[model samples]
Target: MKIDDWLLEILACPACKSPLRAESEELACTSCGLIYPVRDDIPVLLVDEARKPS
Candidate 1:
């Protein structure tokens, strides 16, 4: 999954408005313990759809 650098730069966690770091196939919030999934290169940033850090 590839998201544009510019877009990723501006993308933040919907939950805590924290910066996100690109992981295998997800984006992890730096502040909150939320892991957002990337489906078909699209970041699923919905808070309800986020997975709590394990």
Candidate 2:
């Protein structure tokens, strides 16, 4: 699912508090490289739920 531009603009990484960029079906942290999943169009910002950058 695609996240809205406005929401993507405000969404931050729960771990590093850095800005996130929409990537396909996930929101990836620009700073810390944590990949947050977008489930049902809702961003799962939990640090435990995030995937480490590969």
Candidate 3:
């Protein structure tokens, strides 16, 4: 499922404790520049699995 607008208010970056925005299929943290993947309708909010900024 897609991330709901209300969920954005509570979802924070697991790495930097920063705010996150819903990208195409992931959650992107502007502060840390990390992209957390969304798989099987679940957000994989893990730093180790997150994509590094390019």
Q: Write candidate 3's Cα lDDT for 1-54 as tens digits.
A: 577788888899999999999888888997988999999868899999999977
Q: What is the lDDT of residue 37 in candidate 1?
A: 95
Clashing pairs in 3: none
lDDT of 2 by residue, 1-54 (tens): 867788888888888888999889998999999998888989999989989988
lDDT computed for candidate 3: 0.88
Clashing pairs in 1: none
Error (Å) of candidate 3 at residue 34 is 0.6
**Whole-model lDDT values for every prediction:** 0.91, 0.89, 0.88
Worst 10 residues of 2 by lDDT: 2-11
Scored by lDDT, the top model is: 1
What candidate 2 gets wrong by more than 4 Å, as runs, is none
User: Which residue segments of model 3 deviate by more than 4 Å?
Assistant: none
